[model samples]
Target: MTIESVLSNNRIIAATQLKDIKRADESQCCAMILMNGKLSELMHMPMVHKPLFIHMDLLKGLKNDKEGIAFLKEFINPTGIVTTKGNLIEAAKKEGLLTIQRIFLIDTNSLKTAIQNIKDYRPDAIEVMPGIAPKIVKALKQELDIPIILAGLITTKEDVLHAFEAGAEAVSLSNQLLWNGTTEAITTK
Candidate 1:
């Protein structure tokens, strides 16, 4: 499918499994995939076909973070740094990385703390958990200019379709399932 296709078109983005990432990413069937961790294993794959999205904690925990971030800047910046710190959001902006601040799983106080981070750090998108609630999606869309991407328990084509219909611009693939880049979920004949 073309990149311009609607978020539907069964827009499948395969999640990288910890050990299987290399094989899964290299699998010819999967045309659209996102990966976390090191890229050395994926060198054989064409860069245009392989898009990478990384967890913030993994990036931050790198032994040589400066070098790692420098290398990452070349291909797919962190989708967003999942940080309780919120300060890292500012750093991401300064370093010119698109960010998604993962909250919702944290406590009420941390969630409250994250609101100001949105104001100050100004991420490109903010994600909510366990699927997007229309009310919450509306509030976040109105409160911030950034788009929303929903995470967790978002399975099946209906769930994915309902999410964007509800106001989320995108919904992350359930970690338990990766599309393997095939058009099986694409709903194309």
Candidate 2:
């Protein structure tokens, strides 16, 4: 299924920055971005009903190559994956997993590079860093066909609303309160 279909109702995805299993379990978000969890920890953690998108960078014991992708698919069995690497995104797609390519928009050059990469890799969706850049989000939304997930530095209801207004399909934030506090606003959108 499409990322948009999965995230259509849930606008705030829990971004688990640390290995806080308790916090993740307590979160109201229906989707999660596992930013910092070891392979063992992830494997052992109790599964929640929502979709889990593992961050390849923070996850240990995997090579981020074809073999690692295989391991993730066979063993970890995540609903999807998040990575900045185009190759990994391609590999994950081959393995029948949804992919979210994380792009850090530091400047114009980076944005250009990310756009080119998107054309090449064709991930199911993309997560843009520093979600405050409404202009950049609007630009990317205008250019890209896939859904955009605005992430990072999003701690308030206004930030969430602004991202949605700028054309982000959803927003990922580490703050749990925002997940609860912003649901009404997102649902009404």
lDDT of 2 at 39: 76
User: Clashes in each model (backbone N, CA, C under 3 Å)?
Assistant: 4, 0
After superposing candidate 1, which stretches have Cα over 4 Å from the reference?
A: 1-12, 18-48, 59-68, 71-85, 105-111, 132-134, 175-189
State the lDDT at 55 in candidate 1.
62
Local distance difference test scores for all models: 0.52, 0.83
lDDT of 2: 0.83
Worst 10 residues of 1 by lDDT: 1-10
Give the per-residue lDDT of model 1 (tens digit) for 111-155: 566577778766666667756344467656666776666676766
Q: What's the CA RMSD for each of the models?
A: 5.5, 2.0
Give candidate 1's whole-model lDDT: 0.52
